[model samples]
Target: MSKPNVLLIGTGGVGTIVAYGIDYAGKSSLSVVVRRDYPKVKDQGWEINSCNYGTIKGWKPAAVYESVSAAGEAGVTYDYVVISTKSLPDIVKPEVLAEPVITPGKTVVVLVQNGFDLGRPFIEKYPENVCLSGVSHIGSHNHNGVISHIQTDKAVISVFENPHLDKDFQVEKAKEFISLYSNDKNDVSYFEDTKWYRYRKLVYNATLNTVCALTGVDTGRLDLSGTLESVSIPAMREVVKIAKADGVELPEDVINTVVHSDDGDWFEPSMRVDVKKGNPIELEVILGNLLRVARELKVDTPVLSLLYELLKAVQFRLKEGQGLITVPEKRPISTKYYS
Candidate 1:
């Protein structure tokens, strides 16, 4: 039997480890779409230092393409097209990226990005294709072409439940992906209700990821600064309430667990990293969408609301810096109070 062909888009911290996992699983031949770092990755390859796979020097996927269109033009129908890009709907849509390579009913579109309801666009766009939602709990970062895997390596994948597709068939394909993505080094399991898992992840992202980005604080400093008790826990509790209002009942202990999950580590969450790097954070998918649910359900999220407003200000500056938006010049006004 021939190995399954897998194509991964986005080679960030999370994407790099996922690429490594697919390669390490050995059941699939991996291909990657490299954008900015195409020349470096295509020529010199990646250097991955994983806690699970140890040190793998000069690692490259089975194939590499410069763009999704280029990968689509290759004439190879991939079994899975894993999207690990940041979920920034304000910037780009996931379906736009996956549509080029998707083979309608054949290819399974797997979303490994963060944020709630991340698979909806893909499901709507590729109704004939199986859409799977993946929630990964891994601590990894990519600096240049070198990857550093620090903490946990566990992932849960489940079908997004598209009415247009067969449920049983989706389950089988999800299992196949698990088989190809799991090994002794890392853990990948099948989840029945992945949205619940995504909401559970929100307990961490909505609170720590958002707060740290605003305060410029890392996980370890958050504990020492007393913000963990004053702000973090309250924000997490609100997320839990919002999740319940949206029909997902996360455990009461989730807040405590997510709080101490990074007990002694001085790690910066993804959002904070983006802020430091002057990159547009995943504001919409991470907090914006979740807050929308809260509003419709009449769930009060003062902490999250305030955080969102502050972060929106930050995102405005980032967008302006990246030239995604242009700011009009200020106009002179005469007012008695101004004197």
Candidate 2:
């Protein structure tokens, strides 16, 4: 199997995990982009903590670029570019991020992040066929440059028609990716139902993440038996309703299936991680999206609206104590959520 040259744009937990997965696959060459002080970031090689790879030794990437422009200028090319940036609005913009991060090689770009709209900007930037939409179930915190893998369920994905894949074997590429994560912990799988998978994930994040963000509780601590029944379960069904209204074909009970099992407890969500790290909350990433969808579909979501309000309220209270606006904490909501 010929290896593909890979360029990863972000160096957060997800980026580190993907780098490990790609290296293990032995079917992809990997490079990860760090910030201005490449020397500083590179000084500390990646320490990945996964059951599959244990507290393994650090592995440096084939190439490291401080910026995409520098990598492009340096004549480094890639067959695929995986974007794992978390904060969408700041990192991804029209002017700063409009340039194609991937070169005109055998490059097929995949966007790995939370939220359905996370890849919307990429889809807008590139032709649909050239882009692949994906979601990772791994959880981690950047514990002093080390990626501590909290939990990993599956790598779920739905392929969009990205123009770049024409030069490559699409199934071959996906299988290569899936094989990389065929460990006991995380399994990568591809589904043809891109829209459904997308919405289904939205259901998972909106329920798991939004509630966690509001309550400031990790999935490990919460008693979700009741949440799975009344709050989370109903909210998930409501999300499906909004999706169907907006023409997203999702399964009947994907939420109940993927989220609430008879497990003892769960893991910390990215939203909660963002809060704990004192980074701006991803309210838009989890809630504002469906709000937009509700507007488009004219769906009513009272429970979601209340959740939004409470999330905003908590964020406001926290930011007030911190003496800053606190990273998009302005809930700025009302009963406007139509489904």
Candidate 3:
């Protein structure tokens, strides 16, 4: 039997682990799509220090392309197209981002990004394809070409409910993916339904991620500053409420479980890291979409709404810095606001 062909779209912290796990499994031939670091990565490869895989000096995929189109043009129909990019629907739609490599009825679209309803656009766009939505619980980073994996990878993967594909077929596809993705130390579990799982994770992401970014604190300091109890937990409750209203019944102790899921270590969440680096944080898919759901479902989210509004201002500044949008000086000027 021939090895399955996999195309990875992102090479960030999470993407590195996704590639490593798949490659470590040695069950599939993995290719990657890198935007700017293709030349360096192709030549020098990566220095990976992982908790699960120990220390790998230099590592690179079977092939690295400049873009998804380039990878697609290679004429190999990918068995799995794993996307681990930031979920910024306002910047780029999920369907549009993955459209270039999709093989209609043959390819399985695996979304390993954050945010709610991550697979909806893919299912709508490619009705013939199976979409496996996964929630990654790992702490890792890619600094330059050196990849550091601090936490062991624990992923929960589930097949999105697709009316076009048979239920049994979806399960088989998900199992095949799990087999190709799981290794000795890294744990990957398959679930029948992941909507509840996504919501459960939002209890962590939508709260700690936004709060820590806005407040400029790591998880430990945030907890030490009494924000975890007074602010983080309250925000988490709001997410649970919204989930229940959206017909996803999370456990009563879900918030507590998420709060203590990790030790109160001095580490920044991904959103906070993005904010500190002057990169645009994932606002829309992370909180904006959830807020929209709250509004439709009539679930009140004062904490999340306030965070969203504040983050919108931060996003505006980020956009200005990135030259995505220009702020007109004539519109309004307030030096005191910065102070």
TM-score of each: 0.89, 0.75, 0.90
- Model 2: weakest 10-residue lDDT segment is 89-98
What tens-digit string does per-residue lDDT give for candidate 1 at 1-339? 888889999998888898888888898988999887899988988888888989988789889999999999998999999999888888888888777899988899899988987777787888888888888889898788788999768999998888887789999999999999988889899999877988988899998999999999998898899998899889998998988888899987888789888877898998998899999999999899889889989999999999999999999988888999885698556565753
User: For model 2, what is the alpha-carbon lDDT of residue 1?
Assistant: 59
> How big is the positional error of residue 222 in model 2, measured in Å on the Cα after superposition?
6.0
What are the Cα lDDT values of the candidates? 0.88, 0.67, 0.88
Give the Å shift of residue 238 in candidate 2. Answer: 1.5
For residues 19-80, write the lDDT of model 3, one tens digit per residue.
Answer: 98999899999999987677878888878899899898768889889898899899888999
lDDT of 2 by residue, 1-339 (tens): 566677777777776777677666665677778763366567766677775567865567778878888766767556677777775452245214525455443466777766665555555555433566667777665666767876764577556544544524655565555665355445778876666777777776788787777667766455544564567667887898998897786766577575664256667776776677666566665687678778777899987878877877666655555565544558656777689
- C-alpha displacement of 280 in model 1, angstroms? 1.3
Cα displacement (angstroms), candidate 2, residue 260, comes to 3.1
Root-mean-square deviation per candidate: 3.2, 5.6, 3.5
- Can you give the lDDT of residue 52 in candidate 1? 90
171 in model 1: Cα distance from truth in Å? 1.7
Candidate maximizing lDDT: 1
- Assess candidate 2 and give its TM-score to the true structure: 0.75
